[model samples]
Target: MASYELNAFDRRFQSISLVGAIEQVSPYTLNVGYWLRDPNQLILYPDLVASHPRLDFLWEKTCFEIFIGVQGEDYYREINLSPSQAWQAYQFEEYRYPETMPPQVAYDIELNQLKRTHYGLNVSLDLTEFMLAHKLKWSDLFIGLTAVLETSQAQQFYAMQHSGQNADFHNKRDWLHIF
Candidate 1:
């Protein structure tokens, strides 16, 4: 597992530190985990009882995101997982450009808020299948991990690397390499 510490696009998150792990659970499964310290410091949306429909913009509020792709590839996949355990996955042919995703694929997410100290979300997906659909599970992969935080006063962005002189997590230069 590769551990990552994210920086806030906005300085307000100075007291908030986001950390997580990304690893291959098996040839077919990819496991990801991200934890938010001090859950009370942000205004998170209410949890949903079931999975959300695909393509919903959960990022508008409080949510966690993962961007994956083969190294040096312009096309990539993005997954959005919310504290409510709802999720959306998309294949981008290019930056902010959507492509047709496979008709069927398995995606899973487990969400939890641990009292007042932290909030954690764990995800397991058939990345191998997704990769196969795209091409192959290349030996070298890159992932851009991010989270959107909402406070009572405003919304903030946090990512592997800050971009756009703003909170633009879509900047490919900010994605982190993973194997």
Candidate 2:
């Protein structure tokens, strides 16, 4: 399973992939067997530094709030793992954004401004984890935001669901068998 976190106003986001087994019976859980991507590739942009001087200092120590799980046919579900369980799994981080950067901070203010601009997650997981964990020779993993919902009520409803619970299904009602 993989997990990631991003600030609401902050465009930055990150995800990590893990190779592991799914104990969907007894534990009904997913495990991180190994990490596919190298951690070095993950990089953080300076813009994530909150404008305030005091807040800027906290950037390094700031923990990215994360949600984790595997993506199902129509949605992503949270992986219900205890803290101890996460510690035992193999994990790695990957980063994305800023298609390019300049070598030096000199001359152009515009360039310098762009230098601080960050548009994606601060970290991500190596893709190799997904392939290994799923028992597939190859796979592709994508991370992004959901821009649309079927209904305003549905949108608010799922937002609450996503924020409050960690489960295998996005909509608990969908899983219920009504008599």
Q: lDDT tens digits, residues 1-179, model 1? A: 88898888877557667887787776667777887775456565646645444547678778888887667678777787777667777667677774333312234222222121235777776665566665666475788899887767677788888857777777878887567
lDDT scores of the candidates, listed in order: 0.69, 0.22
Top-lDDT structure, candidate number = 1
Cα distance off (Å), candidate 1, residue 162: 0.9
- How does residue 169 of candidate 2 score in lDDT? 25
- The candidate 1 region of ten consecutive residues with least summed lDDT is 108-117
